[model samples]
Target chain A: MKSEDLETVRMVVHARSGVAVDISKEYAIESRLAPLARRDSFADVGELVQAIRARRDEGLMWSVTEALIQGETCFFRDREPFALFRDDMLPALAARADRPVRVWSAACSTGQEPYSLAMIVDEVAPRFPGLKVELFASDLSERRLEKAQSGLYTQFEVQRGLPIRLLVRHFEKVEEVWRLSQSLRQMVRFRRINLLADLRALGQYDVIFCRNVISSLDPALRGRVLEQMAQALAPGGWLVLGQDERPMGLTEALESISGWDGAFGRNPAFRAAA
Target chain B: MKTCLVVDDSRVIRKVARRILEELGFEVAEAADGMEAMAWCRTAMPEAILLDWNMPLMDGLEFLRQLRKEPDGDQPIVVFCTVENDLEHIALALESGADEYIMKPFDGDILSVKLMEAGVLA
Candidate 1:
């Protein structure tokens, strides 16, 4: 990634995800753009960057981001997190809520995280009796959001992380592709959210899953992003990260806790302070 | 009649698989997702299964994992039909107990050859 192209990615990602990406991760940026460059038959990243700047199509911006963003997601990814949410998190949240429980899947690429959350909610919904559960899934990439909204996957996508029984019950066979049932599709609301924007307007969430997305960010920007995310989380609510990422040294507001592979809790003092 | 279960979420692939299997003289049953496939397998016991990898609810990998745990687990000659062309993915499929693995955009002839190799057809 050239300095100019890196700047463009940084600006776009910052605008969309609120995570400031450093130009230093040139290899990462270059690897992501290789496919786009090849697809467009551009000679190099420089040519691709030039073309991107010349074209003001909003769709192109999203495509660039989609190409760059790590959409390394599969159905029921990292079984431990979803398992923890189903077995421990939702029940606890349900007990505390007087009204419906709201879970936010921040940076929900292509809808895997939120859909996983919905499946868990659906399983426990019958037992909750009066408690209503709503899953709000958001991504920076409109293209990804569109795919999430479609709730359709190729045979390859369905195989990666999903279990068999759940596949049969929740999806319908259209031909060779698996499409999520109307019920499951309806459970999640896919929105294009710029995480760096005003998350205060998004309201409080019982559980915020911002996983596998922070690696793109610089430390300072990551800290700010986490602080904003913390503000959006309800007191005692949990925040889950990708297995490979950590909150340590990023923010003091979230304390690492023993649950869901690895999770962080809103500091009681920080909640009071906020 | 010999039965085969074509498990995938894509309508196009399922149609293609169904047409190919039907032409080969095997009874074809279809399931959209892993859960549905499991339910069908419980009562139907198809002789062969062509399973997709990525799906909603339960995915192909999880389906394979659960299928392997069943009492008559190794009954079907399971083939993984997916777009994940990575060698790691192929190894993972084989490790998960798939009897055969084929990449997507395949021709009917390849499907027939795989079926014959699995002893599902003469």
Candidate 2:
């Protein structure tokens, strides 16, 4: 509400998540933080701001950061990318059969993207025989990861961007919501990860979905983050961003894959043999 | 606009489905049971049929079997929207020529997405 509180919220969110909060959308920022404010027994955004400014509670700060940066997502949020993963990427990986294929859904808010990947793998991987596809999903929010790991979704949640056929196949009706089958749930490993940190500990991925993530990063950090992602990708690996986004010639390590929209191929020169 | 026949015994369910389909720009028709659906089809075939299981006189499976035997019966897309959630039930529906299946207690969005998936709606 006040100028000082506005700048404080902006600084905290940006420093932690690398997401730039628009001061112009003051109502949006307040709306996003309202629930968190209530949870901490604060009346409104102003009080929540004062709490953050005064306290060194790491947990509260993380919660506030996630509240601001998290996004609304659904299963198979976009049709074409899942189609690409199912038809083209899986076939290519299945052909190899030599090494395990690791796919990461980074900034995987509430786990839809990775779970969607698991649904495809569950259906199609059987045809290939012995194709080991390991799926890793991560978000900066511990809260989101918990929900993702639980494999539960409301009727509304399950309905969005999901065909009824797959819903019936992989999820069992639970009261008013649907619980994803244990098989699909177990297929993915969920973790809380900050992209601004060193990602090498998560290991290199053959196919990484950093979709809708880098576009939100502070412009100052975009190039550095892209280079870090480049190093974390295996040679000839794939990196999928949001359909509307690209590297925009930010770094040479990643190049747009011809014919593939919003997908980049890792250049071998980016990282030596490991 | 394309035509869709809602085949269900429940008036409330039919009404609910009708409201949703109408909003999606489909010319909606109603059938109380499979026999009525059959009669309607014999007179004028709809582009799509939202079928349900467990009806008076003729059930959904029997109707599907009989419908396929009719001339130009394969033309209309059939989607089973029922309380049947079992794999065997789904498999049987598919075997009996259901293009898609939706479980009971679904909402407008679920119905909408399923219809789109069946190519009955854009």
Candidate 3:
């Protein structure tokens, strides 16, 4: 692809979704977008870029931007966070006078993270007695949101980071694919959302899982998103970042909860309570 | 290195599994079927057993049942890696003394992680 094309695509992706594309990884970027070009009947990436530069097709802009956005997610991508959700977060939220605990999976990619959260809630719901947990998942890509709502996963996806025991329990074999049971699918509602937009209208959540998301944002947007996410959390609600991530001095509203990896909260009492 | 018995009817699966298990630092052994696995276990018990379901001359579940009767059979961590994917199948394997369950089409990472979960590897 031409340098101008590369720059244009990178800028569009970064501007739209806050995902910064590394110029050095041009080969990876081309490989990911090549299929999109072919699917759209473009002979090659250069022609695709030519079309994109003309800005004739408005849909292609979103397609390329969505394609360029990274969507690497699987069931329970990291194990420790889910364990904390099961043992600590669920109990704390259930203890609150709030009837239905609200959880948001921001930039949730293909829905594995939120579905995993729902599975945990379903497993422990009997103990809570009339427990109601509302799960909301969102991503920038509409295609990915559709797949997430489908509740289908490949054999490899079901096994990756997911305990196989839960695989048979929560998912049913559908020919070559595995579909997460309908009840679990109903537990999550997916939406096409941009993190850069106003989020207050979505209301507050008891737990917000924004793992591996804001870290990918351009430096300017990180602080803005961090503060907005902080405001969106219910009082004493936890914000779980990526496993290896910290707030990095972006915002003072979040403080790390000791022993809970990648988990932060407005209230310091989360540690004492957990 | 700790010893692990790799039992499967498929030569290709056994070969692939042996490679991955060896890569995870296990001294690997192979058995074509349950009776053969049983015969091998009587002489020298391995620290771990990767059993496959639906093998000839006795299947994994029966082998596990028979193995539990042996003096130190319960010592080896039994993990069934097979294509038999159902809640009942997994539950039965656990009820029959298996330590772990991995569905077929596995990779090195899957084997390494499952073995670690079984407490057979650090």
lDDT of each: 0.79, 0.85, 0.86
What does candidate 3's lDDT look like per residue over A1-274, in tens digits? 6788898888778777888888678898899889998999999887888897786476887898888877998777767788899999888777874578899999999889999999898889998986688999999999999999999898777777676667767888788888998989998999888999988798998899999987788877887788778778888788999876787677666788788878987743322211
Give the Å error, residue A79, model 3. 0.7
Q: Clash totals for all models, in order?
A: 37, 0, 0
Q: Tell me the lDDT of model 3 at B55.
A: 92
Tens-digit per-residue lDDT, A1-274, candidate 1: 5677789877766555555555798998887878878887999877877777888556656666677666778766766788788878888877887877878998888887788788888888898887788889998777788999999987666655554445656876677777899999999988888776767899988888888877766566787778888888887888888888887788777788864567788776654234
Quote the positional error of residue A11 for candidate 1 in Å. 5.9
User: Tens-digit lDDT track for model 2 on A70-170?
Assistant: 57788887677888888888898888768889999988898889999999998896798889999999898888999999999876687677876787688
- Model 1 residue runs over 4 Å out of place are A1-45, A51-62, A258-261, A271-274, B1-122
TM-score for candidate 3, please give it: 0.90
Ranking by lDDT: 3, 2, 1
True contacts kept of each: 0.00, 0.41, 0.18
Query: Which residues of candidate 2, in runs, are more than 4 Å off?
Result: A268-274, B6-37, B51-69, B80-96, B103-109, B119-122
Docking class of 1: incorrect
Tell me the fnat of candidate 1. Answer: 0.00
What docking grade does candidate 2 earn? acceptable
Instruction: Tell me which of candidates 1 and 3 scores higher on lDDT.
Output: 3
Docking tier of model 3: it is acceptable
